[model samples]
Target: MRMLAVVALLNLVLVASEAITLEPCALALELTFWRMSGYLGYTLADWLCIVHHVSDFSIQPPLSKTAEKAYGIFGFSNKYWCSDGVQPSRNYCNISCEKFLDDDIQDDVLCARRVLTRNEGAQTWPQWAEKCRGKDLSSYLKDCKL
Candidate 1:
């Protein structure tokens, strides 16, 4: 009985350690894409599509870090309340997610910019800043020219 208990505890610890390190929202992005793909959806094992394909630069600060990164994935973090609420396809472009996973920073940045543009009339500086993690990414987004 004592040996069994030890083995059970060890297994629990191993499971915990092997858990996915990606943030809840990040994982959601990949999962959403895969699910939206329907029967054609592709996933490397149980992991989401983005996880397997995300480039090194995708995780960089501000862009993929902080609240700004959350905006990229969730679009208006506060509106979604971080991880809950309906996610609309029209507001948040599905194309951008694919481009982001591909490490196409330009398109990814453009996606973010498009959202900002659409929301410009409705969002205040504070809301915009909060969504972008208090950073102005205008220059970064428009530089792509496409």
Candidate 2:
């Protein structure tokens, strides 16, 4: 029946969209790539730890309930870092927030780097100060063979 075929096609499309939207990163692999990309100001471990608390390394993190929604792996804010279309923004990263929600994180990393440079470092993220800072962050990279 055509209706059955249509339902099957819709299910297939849904599955495909879910796969595309939920591409999570593997930690060691991402770390290796990030290091090669020449990210500075924080150790890879520190970055991992910060990301752990911020978005649990989720590429498309859930939108926060607050007025200023944060996005992507680093939870870059719509208000200051990127544009989410819902809020007024400075968009200092000069990028659309939707771009951060995909598996390709090179742009996200670059934006986060800009945030670090302008905001004076990792302390720009309150989660870093509350959870990752001054902690023994060596464990974050322990399993990563990098």
Candidate 3:
């Protein structure tokens, strides 16, 4: 009877720990992707202003380099979470990273280049975030806004 109780308690603790770690990291990853994408957009905005000689006071950019560096500094601020042991998030992260490297970054960089070349200004982060919420980033990068 004592052995049975111990086993049950261990199982419960294991299950609880498992639950806590999984969902939050997945949520965090989605948030990170959008935030990164938004920063990229914002950086292009700043570059555009500089090239067009817009007044520094009126111009604002996303600070993409800073954001990338921050990914190095903090955790979600620095670390990218990857879950293993037959978890969906782990598989998803690998696949997502590959896709981002192969496709999304290229497309975004091209878009950023175009936006920077135009004299017209780019949207502020709030506006960009709103637009990003609906757009999908393949499978892993989900917009949690709605």
Candidate 4:
């Protein structure tokens, strides 16, 4: 019994150490790109060219994280809270465990889940930032001609 307890405690410490070193998620990629562009003196024309994949500077969306980089596959930081509730640590949340339909954004209350899962795609930044008027994505989504 003593030997088994020691092994279990060792395994627990290993797991905790591994979890703390996970990388920040890809949602931060756009901010990094813009910063690099600014440093390199890139212009609006350069951005257009890059977005359309017409140049070597074109951005590729990063792949989901692998298990070696995180506790799970698709290494997105699962430590996010919805518009409704708090997530305790990572991958665990206090949100209701309710199920709903895919075509369900019309209702205001139902929009919480969509907000939780929606991608910060290039297409929606305009509308999303508009609605998120007082929210904190402001500087990272700073005004830039593109």
RMSD to the hidden true structure, all candidates: 13.5, 3.2, 17.3, 15.5
- The lDDT, on a scale of 0 to 1, for candidate 4 is 0.30
Model 2 residue 77 CA deviation (Å) reads 0.6
For candidate 2, list the clashing residue pairs, or say none: none
Best by lDDT: 2
Residue-level lDDT tens digits of model 2 in 9-93: 9999786455233222365467567662236557776777777887776665454788798888788889999997888999999
TM-score of each: 0.27, 0.80, 0.20, 0.20
Better model by TM-score: candidate 2 vs candidate 4: 2
lDDT (10s digit) by residue, model 1, range 44-80: 2212222223321233222333333333322333232
Return the candidate ranking by lDDT, descending: 2, 1, 3, 4
Error of 2 at 68 (Å): 1.7
State the C-alpha lDDT per candidate.
0.36, 0.75, 0.31, 0.30
Off by over 4 Å in 3: 17-29, 32-36, 39-146
- Tens digits of per-residue lDDT, candidate 4, 19-126, equal 211112221243244343333343323223322221122122222363211111111222432211233333233332221111121221222223334644222224
Ranking of models by TM-score: 2, 1, 4, 3
TM-score of 3: 0.20
Question: In candidate 2, which residue ranges exceed 4 Å CA deviation?
Answer: 1-25, 36-39
Candidate that would win on TM-score: 2
